[model samples]
Target: MSKPLRVVVWSTGWIGSIAVEAVHRRPDMELVGVWVHSAEKVGHDVGEIVGIGTVGVVATSDADALIALRPDCVVYAASGPERDTAAVPDYVRLLEAGINVVTTTSTRLVYPPTFTAQWRDALETAAKAGGTSLYASGIFPGFGSDQLALVLSTQSSTIQKIEATEVSLNDHYPVADVMMDGMGFGRPLDFAPWLSRPGTIEASWAGPIHLVAEGLGAVVEEVRGSLERALADRDIEVAFGMIPAGTVGAVCTRAVGVVDGREAIVIKHIIRMARDVAPDWLGSECDATYRVDIDGDPDIHCTMTMGEMQGHAAGRGAMVATAMRVLNAVPYVVDAPAGLLSSLDLPLTLPRFALRTAHR
Candidate 1:
C-alpha cells in the first residue's frame, strides 16, 4: 500500500487539540510531529496533550524543527483572530519548507479570490517556491458559508436569493478569544467586539457570499452586514466563563450579498453564550446547526446539526466537525497544484477510512 501521508498538527488549542485527535484516528495518515505555541505544551506527548493515549510523538515549539521533518501536510489549526496577520507568516514558512497546509484559522483564505494582491501573491509565491499548497476551511467560512449554500442550489431551477445561517450554542465552547475577543459574546453592551467593527463581517464572511454567488453564475454588487446584541438580565453560566448580569449574552450577525439592489446571498450567525439567550433568532435548545435557505423556482431549506462522536467531547460535535473538515482535506490539499486553494478549487473531501473502527 502507498505510504501513509506524513502529517503534523500545528497547535493544541481548542480546534487544534481536536484536529490532533482526528489526525491520529486516521489510519491512512501518520501523525509525525506536532508544533505548539504554548511553552507548557512543548515536549508533552501529542497524544497526551490532546487527551488521547500516547502515540509516541512529542510536541515542539520550535517551528524550524518540525518543518525540518518535511511532513507531507500540516494541519495549521492555530487560532488567528487577526487572520492573515497572525497566521500568514507561519503558513508562508511552512509552504516554503515544502509543507502543505490545511488551516481553520483564516476565513478569508476560504475563498482565495477575495484576497488582495499582496496576500494572495505572498502565499502563491511561497507555495510555488516549495511546490506546496494551502487550503483554509472550517464550519463557518468553510462549509456553512459556501459549500452548504452552493450544494443546496442544485435543487433550484430559478434563483432569487440564498441565505446561509449558523446557529451555535457556545455554552460548551470555552475559547475565550473566540467567544469574547473575536465574537464579542459575554462582553458589555458598549464594548465593541471584533464582530462589530466596520468591514469585519464583510471581510470575514463576504468570501462565502461571493463564492456562492460565483458558483451560481451571479454577481454580488454590494455586500452589506448587520449585527444585534442580546444582553443577559441575570448572571448565567457558560463554558468560557460566567456571563455577568447585564452583559452581552447573544449576538446575531448578518452579511448580505446584494444583487441588483436586492439581497441575493446572505450569511447570518446566531451565537449564544447560553441556550436561551436569543430564542427568536433560531432554535432554543442548545446545539449547533448550519442551515441554508434557498429562494428559487423550488425553495429548499437544509440544516445540518452535529451529535457527539465517539472520541470528541459531548455537545461539541460542531467543533469536531470543523476540525475534521480541514483535517480530512489533507490528502486533497497535498495532491493539489501549488497555490492558495478554496473549496471551489478542490475535489470532494471524503472521510477516508474514518467509518471503519470506533475509537480505540
Candidate 2:
C-alpha cells in the first residue's frame, strides 16, 4: 500500500475530537500533528485530548510550526463566534501552501459556487497557485439532505417539487450560544433571533437548494425565507440551561427556491426543546429525523431517523457522522482537481472502516 496520507487535525473541540479519532483509526491516514487554540490543551497528547490511549503526538498552539511539518492535508474543525471571519484566511493560507483541506467549519463552503465572488475567487486562486484542493461537508448541508435528495431524484420521471425537512429536538444539542443568543431559544417571542432575520434562512439554505436545482437541470429564479417561533408554557431544562416560561421554545423555518413562480425546492427546519412546546408547528415522531420528499412521476419519499450508534446518544451519533462525512472525503479531495469541490464533484464517500460491533 502507498504511504499513509500525512494529516494534521486543526482544533480539538467536540467535532475536532472525532476528526482526530478518525485519522488515528484509518490505516490509509497518519496523524502528523495537532493544532489547538485553547491554552489549556496546548501541551497534552493528542490521544489524551480525544480520550484514546497515548499515540505519542503532542498538541501545539504554534500554527506556523504545525504547518511547517507539511502534512498532506488538514482537517479543519475549529469553531466559535469568529468562525466566519477566521476560516476563510485559514483555507487560503493552507491551500496556498500546497496542502489540501477538508473542513466542517463553514456550511456555505459545502457548495462553493453559492459563495460571494471575492471569497470564491481567493480560494480558487490559492488552490491553483499551490496545486491543492478544498472541500467542506457535513450531514445536513452535505449529505443528509442536498446530495441525498439529488441522488434520489435520478429515479424520478417528471419532478415537480423537492422538499428536505430536518425535525430535531435541540434539548441535548449543548450549544448555549446557538440556542440562546443565536436562535433565541429561551428569549421572548417578540424578540427576533438570527434565524428570523429577513433572507437569512434563504441565504443559509440556498447552497443546498441550488445544488438540487443544478442536479435537476433547472435554475432557481428566486429564493424565499420564513420562520415561526413558539413560546413555552412552562419552564423547561435543556442541555444548554434552563428555559423559562413564555420564552421561545421551538422554531420552524423554511427556505423555498422558486422555479417559474413555483416553490420547486424547499428546505425546512423544525427544532424544538420539547415536543409539547410546539405541537402546532411541523414535527417528527423521533428524536432526530430527516426526510426528503420528491413530487415527481413516482412521488419519492425517503426518511432517515438518527438513533443511538455504538451506545451514543442521537445527538452524539449525528456529530460523529458529520465528522466522518468530512474525514471520508479526504482522499477524494486530495485527488480532485485543484479548486473548491462539492459533493457533486466527487463519488460516494463511505466510512473508511467498520467492525462487527453492534448497538443494543
Candidate 3:
C-alpha cells in the first residue's frame, strides 16, 4: 500500500491511448509499460504516442518482456476486426503469468459464464493457476444493458421487462468498416449485415441479456436477433462516404431475450446516417443516447448521454468513456479474488486521488 499500483497498457488504438493519459495523471497508479501492435510505435515514449508530454515509459512490442515486469494489472485495450473472438488467448496469456487484466476487448467475458464452455473453462483455469483476476467491461453490454438496468430495477415494485435501447446518430462517426460494413449503411437493401447473420447477435450481446436475467432472478430460454434497414430518401453524405437515394441509410436491430416464453430483455439499436432517415424510429435529444426502459407495474425510464453540448455528441469522447469504465475498476480488480469477474462481483469503483495533482 505504500507504493502506487504498477500498470501496463496494451495496444495504442483509440481506447488504449486514452487509458495512457488517464493512468499517467492518476496519483495511485504508476505507468510501467505500453505494448503496441504496430512496429513503428516500438521504442517511442507512450506519453508521446498518446499525445501527452513524455512520461519516460517507452513502448514495446515484446509481450514476454512486459510479463517479466509482473505489473499489478494490464489494461488490455486492443480492438480491431473480430477482437472479441480473437483476443481471448491474449487475455489468458496475461492471466497465466499472474498478471491481473482489465479489458474492453471481449464482450463474452463481460459475463464470463455466458461464453462457450471451452472459453469459460480456459479463462477460469488460467485465473486459478496464476491467482489473478480478469474483468471485462464497456459501455453497451457492460454498463447500459447489464449494470445500469439492474440498478434501476431496485426502485420498481414489480419488474416485467428490461430493455436497453440506443438511438445513435452516427453521421459524424467516421469509421468506414463499422459505418458501411457492420451496419449496412450506404449499401443495398438486400445487403446482409453481420448482425443479420444467425447467432452473431447472440454471440456478441447475449452476455448482457443473460446477465440481466440472472441479476433479476429470471431465466433466458432463447435469444433472438432481428434487423430492419431504411433507405435514404435523398442523397446523404456521411463522415465515411455517401448514401445515395434509395440506398440503405438507417438500421434498427434488436437482440431479444425470451424468458419463460416471453420477451424479457432486449438490446435495441436504431443507428442512422441521417436523423431524418428513419422518421418514426426511436429518437434521442442528443446525437446519441442510451435509454433503459423497464415495463412493469410502475414503468421506469433512465436516459444516459456523455459529452453532449446542446444536442450534439462528441463522437471521440465515447471511446474515452469506454476506456475509463475499466480503468477505474483496476484497484478493485487487482485486490479481488483470483477468477473471472463481472460488474456483479466488483465493489463501488472510486476514482481515488484523481482530483489531486498528477503523481507522475
Candidate 4:
C-alpha cells in the first residue's frame, strides 16, 4: 500500500477536535501531530485532548514544532470569532513552509476574487515559492454558497437566478453567541448596520455569491440585505442558559442578487432556537433550504431542506469534509501557485486508498 498522508491538525476546539477524530478514523491519513493554543495541552496526547482513545500524537502550542514534523497537510480548525485574523496568519505560515492547508475560515471563500490585493499577492508568492497549495471550503458560506450553486447550474440549460437559505435552531451558548452577538441575531432590523458592518452576515456571504456567479459566467450587478427578528413570549431554559422569553433573540437575514433591477439570486440565512415563534410566511421550522430558480424554455425549481438531523450533522460533517478535501490537495499545493486557493480550483477526486484508510 502507498504511504499514508501524514496530517497535523491545528487546534482542538469544538470543530477542530471533531476533525481530529475524523482524521483518526481515516485509513490513508495518519495523525502525526497536533497544534494547540494552550500550554496545558501542549504535552497531552492528541487523542486525550479530543476525547478519543490514545494515539501517540501529542499537542503542542508551538507552530514551529508542528511544522518541523513536515506534515503533508495541516487541517486548521482553530476556534475564534474571526477566521481571517485568527487563522490566516498560521495559514500563510504553513503555505510558506511548503505544507498544504485546508481551513474553515470564512475569508477563504474570496481568496482568488475578493481578497485584499496584498494578501492575495502574498499567498500566491508563498505558494509558488514553496510549491504548496492552500484551499478553503465549509458548510455555510462554503458549500452552501459555491457547491450547491454549482450543482444547480448542471440542471439549467440557461441560468437566471439562484437563492439559498440556512436556518437552524440552536440553544448552545458559544454557538448561539456567534449568532446572537456576532451576527446581531436579536438586534433591531436595519440595513444601515449591515451595510456599515464589514464582516457581518450580508457582506460575509457576498464572496460565496460572487464565487458561484463568476463560476456560472454571471456578474452580480447589485446585492441587498434584509434582517427579521422573532421575539420570545416568555423565558425559555435551553442548553446554554435561561434566555428570557419575549426577548428579540432570533434573526433572519436575506441577500438578493439583482441583475438590471430584476431578482436573479437570493440568499437567506436564519438563526433561531426552538422556542422562537415560527414565521408564517417561510412555512417551516428551524431548517435550512436551498432553492434555485432558472428561467428557460422549461422553468426549473430545485429545493433542498436540511432539517434538525441534517442541520445538526452540518457542523461536524462540514468540518471533516473540508479537512479531508484539503488533505487530498497537499500534492497540488506543493506544486502550484501559493497564497490562498478555493476548493473550486482543487481536484475533487481524492485518492481511493486514502478513503479506504480513513474509513478503516
Q: How accurate is candidate 2 locally (lDDT)?
A: 0.85
lDDT of 4 by residue, 196-260 (tens): 36445556666777777777777788777776677666666556555566565566778777765
Per-residue lDDT of model 1, residues 1-360, tens digit only: 588999998888878888888777877888899888889988889898878889899999998888889899999877755657878899989999999999988768888888766878889999999999999888887788789788788788998888888887666776788888777777898888888899878877878888888888888898888889999888987777888988888888999999888999989988776666767678634357788888888989887876642223335677778898899899999999999888888888988988778764
Clashes of 4: 20
Cα displacement (angstroms), candidate 3, residue 4, comes to 1.3
- The models' CA-based lDDT, in order, is 0.83, 0.85, 0.86, 0.65
Query: Which should have the higher TM-score, number 1 or number 4?
Result: 1
| Deviation of model 2 at 4, angstroms | 0.7
93-133 per-residue lDDT for model 3 (tens digits): 99999999999988678888888888888989999999999
- The alpha-carbon lDDT assigned to residue 194 of candidate 2 equals 83
Q: Report per-prediction Cα RMSD to one decimal.
A: 2.5, 2.6, 2.0, 3.5
The residue pairs that clash in candidate 2, if any, are none
Model 1, CA-based lDDT = 0.83
Using TM-score, give the best candidate's number.
2
lDDT value for candidate 3? 0.86
List TM-score per model, in order.
Answer: 0.93, 0.95, 0.94, 0.84
